[model samples]
Target: MEETRPAPADLRGYCGNCFGLCCVALPFARSADFAFDKPAGTPCRNLLADHTCGIHTELRRRGFAGCTVYDCLGAGQKVSQVVFEGRDGGRRMHEVFPVVRQLHELLTYLTEALALPAARPVHAELREALDRTDALTRGTPEELTALDVGAHRQAVARLLFEASELTRAKVRGRKKRHRGADLMGARLKGADLRGADLRGAYLIAADLTGADLRSADLIGADLRDADLGGADLTGALFLTQPQVDAARGNAGTRLPGSVGRPVHWAAGG
Candidate 1:
């Protein structure tokens, strides 16, 4: 089967078509990221009756920075409109929303993996996985809630790793292997990290100014409070919006076409 390129918009959160599932289905605690504690299955106090945030514009200023970084990978609307058919199934919707969110996240990665020209050797396998994952999204709420998402995730993860390796292999010179490395607050200014394996690396508050990160596999990397000012992330693999949103950047920070610069980056956050 021929692989069709996936558009970034298709994997993005469209809250207008959603039922605020993220606000109620996910829990948060009082921390630097959140102002107060919110339990799962309960609507956030800021959530309006019409399924919008009352403080959407002021979320970051009001200590709800965590909310600003979240994207459902379009799962909120999928669960609201497709699985539940726009009816608020309450507990059922909440239960299924998280499951679908996980699936959607996987779909996002699979879609991206299929787009990598360097990973073309595995394109057929990637397409099959993408199709299967997409089909699973259309399953009944009962099927979704009971789905062994972890098992599926592991299987997809292996495929993604292979795709990452194939794409990163094209880069000349050393490919730094920092998989799951804890580098929080490390000074890496102007470092050359092209084609690096940085999966699950803790880069919290690290200074990455002018870093060369082209083609780096950043899947599951923690970049909270990291300075990305003047950093180049072009062609970075599996770099999600949430990770970008969690970091600090400047107008000079270069990004891949797949992910957008965080709005807060402009405000010097």
Candidate 2:
């Protein structure tokens, strides 16, 4: 039997081990998500010297909701410790960080796909892709910076698409195809979205209360401010914690075992 891969703890960020890469490397404007304008390579004012967010607990309250929802997919710690050996490489570290982040995201999807019983048909291929992607993440900074991430992403997406099809095929009846659809602020309350292809769809501020999103492919779908109260999202495909955090939900909302309910949900998010 193949060795059981460890749980996806490595796929999730452990900020305590990270070097404040996200706070310094990424750029954000003064949008509704962020409180101020920050340029690339510049550290956020709230990032402490110890590499922890000074306003972490009050990010949402301080108009920094974007920071609260940003998950590095474990790339921050990996780059800090594994890639740079815990030494802040400054510019080089910043450059390699985003590249590894993309790879980690693909790894996250592949690992999740392999765990699904419905995706057994593509298990071999998925395992191979996972191994290859993980290897890429371990490459040197120069190698990572020079890598063709878009091509790799396209290749991984094909496998994820196959895994999604197999899982959704288990759901009988007609399924919706809304890949990359613009559904912002739409009234979709009580919608039957089971097995729907919602990839890259703009769902901002949409009313999804009591909607059935089982087996729906939500990869890259924007859920910012989307109401998920009482929604059934058990078995939702490719759903990330960041997406859940960005959306508004309540205690009645059902979720997959892979993701936990956001704290704000308890307060009627």
Candidate 3:
């Protein structure tokens, strides 16, 4: 796969080279989002042998709603092609599986950074970091085949932390408190919301649909529309997958976990 230029705001734009790793590397519980429980590193039931979703057209119908919300941030393909150099699956790279997963996780953070409004001031810095990481995806086969991906991921994680701090400072309220506040119709789409304490916040109709909510505390947040479709909420605290599945979103909507498409809203109703 040819390496393409990274866009300033589109995160999925980086995933062209991904090998659909998120579908295979993560775990999901049987709930409104998933018809059956699947453990980590195990192939999803809906995943075809060729790395495509077998029920791509019926994710919601099959009860794997969470699968519709995930994006790998292009790390899948980078790892597969650059790191593994077109290596086949079902081989003895089991020792390096963890490294691949970590890299994918880093890619998720980079993707979220590109979506944040607060990060705009430092977009150049973020873009540079992304490019460097992107370059890491083009190492020689020997370098890719024998790299300490864990260390590389940690360095990237540090850069992500710096970017996150810059972005989060913009969202943190002056008083650092927003309990039971009404934020409906708020234009918070694609905001950097990592670790925000949004407990019981009235977020109805708020356009936070594409916000990066990694590790955010959403204990009792009211989320409807606010377009979580395509948002990354991985590791978001106190947010149950069922709550996300029950919420309204279309195929274009993103979620915290899983890479399946949204359930047809009309049919679900």
Candidate 4:
């Protein structure tokens, strides 16, 4: 029998174990995404000393809507505990935060790859890649800081692309092809997007209300402020917690099991 791989924890940010890295280490511009401008290495005004968001319950209402969609993919805790030894007062972790986040994101992709039945032919390769990435996450602060994550990401991305092809190989139809298209602000409410190829689509603020997105490939799609209320996203590929968080959804919205309903979602949203 094949070894039973342990089910992965929520790939989303575990803020309790995190040192609020996103709130401090990353800068934000005053644009549609962020409500205010913030310089790197400075904590957000809403971040409490305990590393919790003071306005967590009302981040959107308080005009900090961008924070609602950011997930560190468990990199925050890894950087906090492993890299900094839970010290939480070091610039080294901050400097390497982006790379570590990328590694964790790769791990998330590999983990999902292992779960896809159609990708079973490449399961061994996926497992090996996941193991390597898991090892990288445990690397020392110096090793992580000096890592070339872009090259590594390219290598892993090739494997992920293969996995995506294998998974969607049987999805035959006159599917819509919108890869990397600028669909921002498009009024796509009730759109029929089943089995569509929407990879890397700029869906920022696109109204996807009641859209049928079953089996749609949404990898790298920017869903920021996209309305997904009452939308059917069953079996949507490459849908992440952050993307779901960025969209407007209601109780009737269908999401993948890997992600939970966003706290900010309402019954009527």
Summed over model 4, clashes come to: 0
Q: How do the candidates rank by TM-score, highest first?
A: 2, 1, 4, 3
Candidate 3 lDDT, 96-150, residue by residue in tens: 4445445444544565566666557666666666666656555654455577786
RMSD of each: 1.3, 1.1, 8.9, 2.2
Q: Please identify model 3 stretches exceeding 4 Å from their true place.
A: 1-20, 91-132, 135-269
Candidate 4 per-residue lDDT over residues 14-94, each given as its tens digit: 898888899889999987667899999888888898999988888767787778778898889888877778886567778
lDDT of 1: 0.92
Tens-digit lDDT track of model 2 for 1-269: 57334358888999988889999999999999999999999999999989988888899899998988999999998899998898989999999999999999998899899988999999999998988999888888999999999999999999999999999999988999999999999999999999999999999999999999998999999999999999999999999999999999998899999999998878778
Error of 3 at 242 (Å): 14
The TM-score, computed over Cα atoms with residue i paired to residue i, of candidate 1 is: 0.97
lDDT of 4 at 216: 85
Better of 1 and 2 by TM-score: 2
Scored by CA lDDT, what does every candidate get?
0.92, 0.92, 0.58, 0.83
Cα deviation of 253, candidate 3, in Å: 12
Candidate 2 has a TM-score of 0.97
All candidates: TM-score: 0.97, 0.97, 0.51, 0.91
Q: How many steric clashes does model 1 contain?
A: 0
